[model samples]
Target: MNRLVKTALLAGAAWTALSGVALAQNAQPASQEQEATSLGEVVVTARRRAEALQDVPVAVTAVTAQQLENRGSADITELARSTPSLTLNSARGSNSTLISFIRGVGQQDPLWGFDPGVGLYIDDVYVARPQAAVLDIFDVERIEVLRGPQGTLYGRNTIGGAIKYVTRRIGDEPSMQVQGAYGSYDQIDVLANVSAPVSDTLGVSVGIARYLRNGYGTNLTTGNDHYNKDVTAARASVEWTPSDSLFFRVAADWVQDDSNARHGHREFAPILDSAYDTRAGAGDDNHVETRGISLTGEWAVSDTLTLKSITAYRDGTTRGNIDFDNLAGPILDIPAMYDDDQFSQEFQALFEGDNWSGVAGVFYMDATASGAFDTVVGLANLTTLTAGSVDTKSWSVFGDFTYDFTDQLSVSVGGRYTSDEKTGTVFRQQYLGIRSPTFGNAAATLLGSPRTNYTRTREFEEFTPRASVSYKITPDLTTYASWGRGFKSGGFDMRGDAVLYPNTVDGYDPETVETIELGLKGTLFDRFSFATAVFDSSYEDQQITTQYPAGATVASVVDNVGSSSIRGWEFEGSLRATDNLVINGMLSYIDAEFDEFLAYIPTGPLNSTCPTAVGCFVDVSSARNFQNTPEWTGAISATWTHWFADGSEIAFTPSAAYRGAYQQFETPAPLLDQESYWMYDASVVWTGADDRLTIGFHGKNLSDERYKTGGYSFPGALTGDSLIAFYGAPRTFTARVGYKF
Candidate 1:
């Protein structure tokens, strides 16, 4: 008893035998409008106003587009596996290198002046580097997810929350849709969209997607197959309302990712036997490309005021290789590249009165980034190459306010003021005895020196605030309380901090948070629905990075390392339970820690708790918490639909998700935790009867389970084989077809 409570009581008896076989096949019955008495009104814009996700008071999770194509979610780590406090990873094998953690903050080294406590947007712009934030959930029309601090109306690094990606517009009439899928390794997916109406006020739309696969490990020394996939994406939009107070919208997008390389495996061995025979003798590959454009305008200035504007530009590039000693020679190798560009602008003014309403905004951004990397050590080839360039500029002003002293009470307030500036330039090179020439001048006089250039600059400012209160006790319930503040900014650490002093390249400061929440949202008897939230956050100057051991190579630094806290809760529910059953559930709990950290511990044993021997920074703050956070997460689903008698319909969905043990770096070595897992997914569909042909089948994990979403640690003094990890994806199935016009 007590092996994590007997594996959570055998995963709660396999979720009660899968919810008693989906409530005994929906226990028959009929009518009553197919039992759905409530749980419909979702609509959200989180607070850029468009309410009703139970009248928003924060804590969101939208997810639409038919629930992301019925859970076959295309990207962003498959919509973070149905969002149970979201956690995603793709780093190393670059699916555009995404690494997102929510509720426990984010940014786990997409390295380039790290920043990203979860915030990514599209439509409200803002998607500044995580190597251009792993988008690709094409044509989406929903995906809100605003969990904790969204700094006074989504401004800056949202302290662990914010993800919008609302697309799908431009429509007046005509339409077309197409989809295709095939699976299990020969995988392929395709999608298309079209919309029409070109005058009488204009409208247009276009979308496309492509995904190809064939790779699940098999690099037994360059026989190729290190996570293969070639991705493609596209989008376009246009809309104009030539009158009725003017309006306009324009959009553009593009993405590409040609993959291979990201099969780190090597879980302790010279060549273990599992991860499908992983070896990758360095013929690695990875590529990424992105493009963007946006424009929006609106004016109505009189039916209760309104004015808006948005402009954007984005660019990206990333190239890679990271066989990082997964064995097969070349000691430890890593090849990297990155390039970036950004531009932004925003303006807003909104109003409504009767008791008040609000919105106000102004924003500006500029960016540029550059990268280079090469690190190969040992085997008589010690080389290092590092390069950097960064430039950033920012500005902001924001506001949000709401009042309604009656009609069920309300209160809201928001504020934001930000400023940021960053600049950097760096370069370094080292090579010793690259083929002997008198041992290359005595190993370049003991490991090269001289080809160091530096420049750094920084500036930052912040003012974040938010407040909320709500009540509506019955009109279908609602209750709320909130407070917020969050900011993240501070840069420079493009490696080069060999203990500061003259090795120059320092600057690590801003990281702040403050949050409090309490919530409830409801609807009951009308067939049930619920939501709950509880949070407490605090953190300050909490930026920490370490990778010490430099002499035989390995250096990464960044500091501020102290202070942290988090407490959480979330509960969600739904039920219809008959007339064709429906049930949904979610539960999450977090307890992140590190209330005063002291970093430096990437692998152990260097006695004396020394101040140095090669590395040592102790105080691991009671040892671990917060890193891909998962203090019990859960999800459940059940759906069924059936109708016939010529009108066609068939649907079935079964889902399960669970995560408990977690840790993927915050240095807790032992292959970096990640246990307690469970995943199962299923789907089925068939339609026709004027629904414009459809068919489907999907399966995932389905109990095959073998997990680890990420990990890295090469100790044995830098790879003589020591922990590499990164596996997730096994058991898959797919089949699909669709059409409409």
Candidate 2:
């Protein structure tokens, strides 16, 4: 038997065993007069309109605030454990920077010029940068994850997928809530929310949160905590409804993270006994701040027509240090700073006829991103300074409509036309000291001439389309087929060395994907529901980023690699075995391969294929693999509730998640890849008789699984070994309390 097939079978067996246990518990005898219970309906806005989840043709997953609270989720990364075909992690050295992938496609480099494969949105406003995108969970109503292309209705064009975070709206009545939690490593968290109505047509709301925790490990050289958290966040909103046909809202939000710089564990010789402990020499001072504000207006022109507008602006700043070589000496140290800002406006018109409904929108955005970093090599008394800035302007117009030929059959189509222009400025130079003059050094001397100093611009235009057909086999069952196209514009590389690679001045071309999918969503027996999908995609002009040695420093290159093919299967289901017990499970499998990869390979004496030069360009598709794409991911969970005679209640929830082995980079590195692993979590909560007071205890990673999330491998690039790995958190326990009035 094949190894992958065997592993998948074992995981499926475990899930079945767990399900059998839940079924046995539900088989107990019940009172003769006990009434039956059914699952509630789930409403979503996946198509820019509110509709039932089963009625939508798209493949999406919706998670409610109650579900998050029950699982004791802290940040967006937790979604990966429940959502199939999704992966998320914190960037290398920053606590708030996000790295996301969906369906085997995504970008890992968080530089100023690179674009993210998965888009992130807050209340319909797009976030242009990933520097401070790892949002904390507080005062949020729900979150939605869309699996495929989402360019028709959204404010931006995302190639792989999109994640939407929706905030809680102001209520009609006055209310206040406060929550607190304390846990391992002296963790302390406080969250508060308040809402009040000023008049019959006006209302306001405010939310505040504070999170603090000690590090999981310590820095031996700096005596600072590692992998700690210290953050403050707040949000405010005002709503006005002057009349019955018009509405307006204004919202503002801010977040600041002051956590210490995160360092990776050395994977070479013995440096420390613990995986989390580090001896990095970089100073421990890191900060990130992000703020945004938006205004939204809606007006009803007629009984079947409406118009809406959204305007938003956001900005962020980051300062941090990264110790590439986690040792006592500054063999490969980096100090970096980033600044980014974006402004966007969107206008939409929605219409509803007797048998047709649709939405048309126009979006425009202008953004700027800039960053600089100093690579210090104390052993050689040399420092390389690299700085770059990118400015972007883009606009798009899109529309989607669904027409019903019959009550049981319908067809939908949508298309988007987008134009993007990017301007980039790159600068790279060398200095003769530990630090550069740009990074607060006053006496640093210039070593040689600048390697790269140029400005360039590129423009790209694309039209993507989507179509779907749906039919209801029965009132309780539905099936659909869809095909969509996705695109992502390319830009110049920030660290490209023009002296060595002259072609870097022109930049790379855009990448695109076209996928076809078939899906089924239905319910049976009023107690079980399931959603399944099978998809195949053709990817073209893929942009690949690589690092190579350049005389005394490292050079970053971006190239338009060849094509690829990807196929996957996803399944999500929930069963209500009893009125008080429910079980949920998800399974996903993906097979991604490079169809053609043209790369530069070194030549050897024994290989006479190309003997004229030191290297030759050849096809290396069979030798490469997709990064961060696991072959199989599975999860199973159960929730049970019990009622006391005095009207009090308690709920018990337990879950387990599994992920198969995957590489971290396109170039395979055995030492950096992570093997298959499983994680377990459980929570218990008790509510008082009045239902206004609650207490909960939660445990995560119960088995204390030690697994890698990300890493860096640059063998023989610096003085010492440069193989470092970052790990997920270990076992943790927390107790939380809350009150409402």
Candidate 3:
């Protein structure tokens, strides 16, 4: 910890010295200057109002549309490569489901009963499920990532952090843009957007996109593609300004993914020719569909006050098959279906006075998530069917206010009171054949009575608070300190088997976190800008998910692990060395450890002490670690622009990112964990003088690094080994052309 503090101080000193030198070199008479070049100011809505990024007391990172384009980012997962203290990837066996974590806090299980530690929002509309949360990047204005708790002002309370995707709005004049791309693996992409004024008081916009790509490897058993992409998406929006004081906007979006089921590589088996290749015998067809609609209205009641309302509805469905063993037989196969729907409403009022500013809001949400899966065990000649559903009704009231005592000093405080109700229904049964009768196997017969058939309800209430103090040493430099609390509700385990574990009927407890942070954000000289923060958090009652052998099958359960402590530091900076050259970089480090962990330990043979045995509790704090929490993450990138004699412009960008080795689960498994790795990406773009024609070429993972992102393991559950691992994308390149009219 001392070493980290010293490093941060040294880095700050170095940046100050460099900025001083640059400023001295550039100083000159204003009358003699022909043109001025400086870093642009960034505006963010982190505090429920538009403000300069450097002036805000919270820690946030904003990525603009041009930045995303330069990096060739396709979806939300790619943002992790450049963002600090963020880990994002696709969940096991699915390509569209997202698993995300920030600062050592997040959720890996995409089940119905569990709540995500990190919140995902699109234009202020909260997404309630992870099933289709890996949104594609197109027609977007910007993305904001808040690092700490966001309980006040946000519709949904998030403990780890929050990610907001802001889309482009309708313009005043008619416009059209079309882009096409061709890449490695026969990848083809088309995107089109159009906007026009319908009347003097209304404007409309529409966008459509199609993305297709060949698989990185082949499925030897099914003769189908593996790790492929096939998606179609569309969005429409209407904006109306009836009067100078009133405004309204309605937006709707839809997405469908028809990609084949992604199969993993068996780590205990012989190495295949390609990391993406598999011999799974499950069906190849997989589908995911998601849609949402939102309406927002704002009224400027007076010069010092404004009223706003937001109403939204969203739904998604996923159907897929997973071959856990990656073998020809159905040793460990799962056929699953998931459905989720949500409706949310929020109202807010803003106040701006001479020395104070504040926002008060009330929010309500009604949501339901249901899923079912059949686990087929051919080696045991039996199957287990697990079906469950969870309904959530939540309401909250929040407010945040800031007061300026003087021009250089300010104080802010905020709080949120939330009430959450969760009702869950679970059913588990055994079947006689290789497949379950519910999965269309008519010959299969029931083995016995239902293992678990019951419904449970739980209610949770919490009051989270936040406070911060800020001081400005100069107009361009500011320092701040803040404290905040966050919460995540808990519910019943969907795959619980009461017959094996009698306590499975009782659900886990909610998790909470208290964090304290100190930060600095400012522009040194006009050419350099930076932001840094150091934080520590106390996490309590963590909900840990684990799989255990139950009779002849495996049951998934969630327990309240004792507690943990997490500390980390983040640094992000950008330097404009020359008029046309810019350099950007970020570095972060996290130290997360369990303070206490009470784990159940078996004392006898599997069958002797299995169902009726009372296990002993053991403190395994020293043996367990946090999942998907890398210790060191860093990235560096540079962009250089050149102008030709014909007035055309071309830009070149090159970047690289590094991530330290980390465990995928609490219990470390060598075969399922990923090692330290680096990824390299580069892009070159050219634009015509008119700024209407553009061409770009991008290359990702140039070194062809093969690394694990997620996996599954169930030891002793089946006769053969069931250790499977999923890999990220291999080397790929693309060429693109775009035009605007």
Tell me, by TM-score, which candidate is best: 3
Higher-ranked by lDDT: 2 or 3? 3
Report the number of the highest-lDDT candidate: 3
The C-alpha TM-scores of every prediction are 0.35, 0.94, 0.95
lDDT of each: 0.75, 0.84, 0.86
**Residue 434, candidate 1: alpha-carbon lDDT:** 30
Write the residue-wise lDDT of candidate 3 on 181-200 in tens digits.
99999999999999999998
* Candidate 2 TM-score to native: 0.94
Judged by whole-model lDDT over C-alpha atoms, candidate 2 comes out at 0.84
Estimate the lDDT of model 3. Answer: 0.86
Collision count of model 2 = 0
Flag the better candidate by lDDT, 1 or 3: 3
lDDT of 1: 0.75
The weakest ten consecutive residues by lDDT in model 2 span 31-40
Question: Candidate 1 on 440-506: residue-level lDDT in tens?
Answer: 2344423556355678888989999899998888777777778889888888777664433232466
TM-score: which is higher, 1 or 2? 2
